[model samples]
Target: MTDPDRPVAIPAVPRPKDRPGRAPAPETTSTYRLGQGPLRLPLWLRAVILACCLVEGLLLAAPLLGLGSARAVSLMLGGFWSPLLGGGTGLYPGQGAVMFLTYGLLHAGLLHLAMNMISLAAVGRELTRMIGAGRMALIYLASQIGAGAVFALMQPQAGPMVGASGAVFGLAAALVGHAAITLRRRRRSMAPLVRAVALILGLNVALTLLMPSIAWEAHLGGALTGLALGLIFAILPRRA
Candidate 1:
């Protein structure tokens, strides 16, 4: 017979989900690796930014190569003109719509080109990561068109307008909308996003007032469109 004073021992349960020496898996998120910064732009984002830069370079170099004034030709062909779109100029139909997209490729000068490329780089990387390249394309194109329409209506006599400021401003506005959605998800206060939006808008206003040549209407239009689309993205479920 066994000894009555003998003690029984309990066995330890093994955790299949975790191992003794292994680290936990990293969290999955729709958010991009923003900590990596702009240098980590994906393929599509890099393509778009590089295309703009190349186009601007070509426009600048065209004149020197005796290509018959690329800037003048670009302004005449692609620049958004209210009169031309409205049939006042009796040009081609739907020309204004074509120019809406093309005008973004044109720049007033080196400074204008540089500013737009920088802005695109800053915003495009994060946005492309968050929304994917395809959605980003939609937002950008929609912003360009919306801004063009607004500029056409607001400044019918403001002369030909050419630049990517509208699209750039739209990207900024979209970030604000994205920030709002992010704050909601984290159950955090939205005061920071609100402040940022206010600052951006205020800066736009100041620039518009100080610089007579700036097309504030286009910026406003693009921003509104971007905000709308961004909110829509935020509300929808994540997709592949």
Candidate 2:
């Protein structure tokens, strides 16, 4: 018998074993869990999507709000017009320089906005994860600048270009470039990357033929810029 004032020593209970015909529950760990959801997107990517949506929303609501044709107003104020590069007066100060990046926020319609936003979300997520948000943003800005430069040089007389397609193409190119570098480093065959390039070019050609109004030049510019940037990033040494 135990003393009344002494602490009782309890017997250790045996651990439960897996029941017959039933699997044991998975052990949860610090790194991951069985039913954990995917990680959320970076802040910058969300901000870009939000900004684009807000711009499009305002344009859509302009008419209902009795503000006249806000779309045209937006294009005039923010669209990338080549003539502006040639000393053309703008509706606002610094419009010529501002249009390069600003045009990405303006979309022609809901469909246009949806497509671009989808592509942006997809590519931006991967890129932000790979190189971080700051570098991704830099690449985006560089791509926009490249697109604007090419458009200004190639389509001097063309109408105002407004869309995020150029930047999207750039991000896609960056992904491709990085993939190509990785494959090369692994001493893998280049056939897959070549096929991807061909596919992209084929799609561009088909789209150009179908929709003559598409800004193919901008896409080209953005792709080239992103590819260069991606190659440089891949070759750079990582900081300790």
Among the numbered candidates, top TM-score falls to 2
Tens-digit per-residue lDDT, 1-240, candidate 2: 645555454544455888999987665423323344565677877888899999999889989989877888888888889998887888889988889879999998998899889989988878766666777788888998998889878998765898988888888898788878988899999998899889888988998898898999999999999999888887875454
Worst lDDT run of 10 residues, candidate 2, spans 27-36
Candidate 2 — which residues are off by over 4 angstroms?
1-37
- Give lDDT tens digits, candidate 1, residues 97-171: 688877888788888888888988888877876777677778888998999888888887665888888988887
The residue-level lDDT of candidate 1 at 227 comes to 89
The best candidate by lDDT is 2
- CA displacement after TM-score superposition, residue 188 of candidate 1 (Å): 0.9
What overall lDDT goes with each candidate model? 0.79, 0.84
Residue-pair clashes per prediction, in order, are 0, 0
What is the TM-score of each predicted model, taking all chains together? 0.77, 0.82
